[model samples]
Target: EAAVTQSPRNKVAVTGGKVTLSCNQTNNHNNMYWYRQDTGHGLRLIHYSYGAGSTEKGDIPDGYKASRPSQENFSLILELATPSQTSVYFCASGDTGGANSDYTFGSGTRLLVI
Candidate 1:
């Protein structure tokens, strides 16, 4: 089964601070994604990578960046945090196939910025 997990499940950051959220996957899948979930906006993709050493911007890449250094790991970086960035972030991994192959999501990382 594909499984993704994220560290620092909850975080509180000050304005203009830097925050890094880490994700690890055991599935060894070639596709991984970072997304943020908001009440009205649903889940919006922030970044994704096809494999190691590649990162691509997603629907809502603003104010966020991603890194995939290896098959099992990915990181989301917030260079200058702000209150608007407070939300639940999720890490997911899946095959290259379409919707037929669903992505597995981490529990989530709830970040609160002040």
Candidate 2:
């Protein structure tokens, strides 16, 4: 079975501090994405990777960094956390090659920046 797992399910960060949210997949998917869920706006893409050693800027990449060290692992990094960055972040792995994309998502990491 394919699965995506995220660590530190909940986190509290002080303003200006750094935070890293991690995700791992067992499905060996080549593409991964990081997104944040906010009130009224729905999910916004922060970053994504086509595969290992490649990272791409998504719709909302200003405050986020993404790393794909290997096919199974991807991480989202916040260099300077801020209150506005507080939201639930999700990591997903899948390919959008065609009409049906089989994406496996992590439960999510809830972040609160004060």
Top-lDDT candidate index? 1
Candidate 1 stretches with Cα past 4 Å from truth are none
Question: Compared with the true structure, what per-residue lDDT tens digits does model 1 show for residues 1-114?
Answer: 657989999999999999999999999789899999999999999999999999999999999989999999999999999999999999999888877458989999999999
Q: lDDT per prediction?
A: 0.94, 0.93
lDDT of 2 by residue, 1-114 (tens): 779999889999999999999999998788999999998999899999989999999999998898999999999999999999999999999976775566788999999999
Candidate 1, residue 95: lDDT = 88
On the 0 to 100 scale, the lDDT of residue 19 in model 1 is 100
TM-score of 1: 0.95
